[model samples]
Target: MTNAMWTHGVEWLTAATPDPRAGERAWLPGDGTVLMEAGRHWDLVSVPRQLGLLTLDILWYDPARTPGPTLVDSAAHRVGFLVPPDPAGDWSGEGVRHASRGAWVAVPPPHRTARSLEWIVPPDACTALHPPVTLRLALREAYETLAVLAPVC
Candidate 1:
């Protein structure tokens, strides 16, 4: 992507925060990351990194379409998939959970990996949020691919 694309991607990430201006301000100073609220512009579906990576593999192989922005915190061993807020209702089950509404997540710049906060699937497009239904289907498929519905987190 071009510089414009990178800028737009960062814009996309910051705009979703609870305070967009502050998010922008933080980015301007090259801050490592900005804390953004979930369940407004988007909701975060948190899962174990192992399963989340499998889910991403499933999404990429779909041939139809891949999932959207995914935030990874290696320090936390977690991956947070950004999707429309609570679209499928309480996602917490087994190895899955979600942060909605007031919950905050550290959002990194699209083109940079700040510490353990980075994007496995960086936001590029204007509407980078994933479709909830597709994400659920992929999660199910990833579990099936593992050959066991076991908890990873």
Candidate 2:
């Protein structure tokens, strides 16, 4: 199947501030937002306005029979996949893998029920990572495509 286009509006959760010790490693939220644009496939997105232009790309993964959604950020060099905990035992798959740091970061799932998952990559990282696209026009085209594909309820 051909790739699908999508647009999502995101807001910064924390104000951008300078870090005293780390030079400029300020924590600004809503970097690149990842969403499931298709069945079992996810998209890493960097919206416009924060940066000069918008950018997006699909994360490559090996298709599995029971694959949960996977998220990837080329800029961050991070890849994470959700693995539901087994009712009788602990989850088996790796949680978070930091490519550059050369380590596997184990992230425990929240105790509460998880309806969805979100991964935010830094906007600057995204800009540095992916090429730009005309987001407004893409969003409009995506809307039209969805309207055509929507099922009758």
Candidate 3:
């Protein structure tokens, strides 16, 4: 069976900040900003934003599955956005695998969870990273694709 687009009920979300030293700060984007179809959920895996030529990686929770309180790491899955490096190039299964290298953000589960790995983009690592503009466009397109894949009704 084809993958069913998830549209979960979201309550709150925290966005990335412009401050570099602040690392990650939690700020609720407010209630009801996210709307997914029944049995489906929206998880903000990563938000690609720039800060002084450096891109920041932000993680978000799906509104539909977020319980009344803090959702445990075990209960959460890292959502991902896949973009083709070459638009005209073949994007078959192999291409998808090759492009998935450092292109993803590693979010680990909690200690009570599996104690998975945790990785973040270092501030000095932007030099080796791709251009900010290109990454931004790719991320935007990925998000749009996610929205389309999600079932509205």
lDDT of 3: 0.25
Error of 2 at 27 (Å): 7.3
- Put down candidate 2 lDDT per residue, 1-153, tens digits, no spaces: 111111111111111112222211221222322222211112222222212111122221223222222334344444444222212222121221112112222211111111232333322111222211333233344444546777989
Model 1 over residues 43-79: C-alpha lDDT tens digits?
Answer: 8899998889998888888676656889888999988
Choose the strongest candidate by lDDT. 1
* Model 1 quality (TM-score): 0.86
TM-score of 3: 0.24
Query: What local lDDT score does residue 26 receive in model 2, on the 0 to 100 scale?
Result: 22
lDDT of 3 at 48: 23
Question: How well does candidate 2 score on lDDT at residue 73?
Answer: 36
Each prediction's number of clashing residue pairs = 0, 1, 10
Where does candidate 2 have its weakest 10-residue lDDT segment? 1-10
For candidate 2, the TM-score is 0.24
* Residue-level lDDT tens digits of model 3 in 6-40: 00111111111123122111112221111111111
After superposition, candidate 2 runs with Cα above 4 Å error: 1-15, 18-133
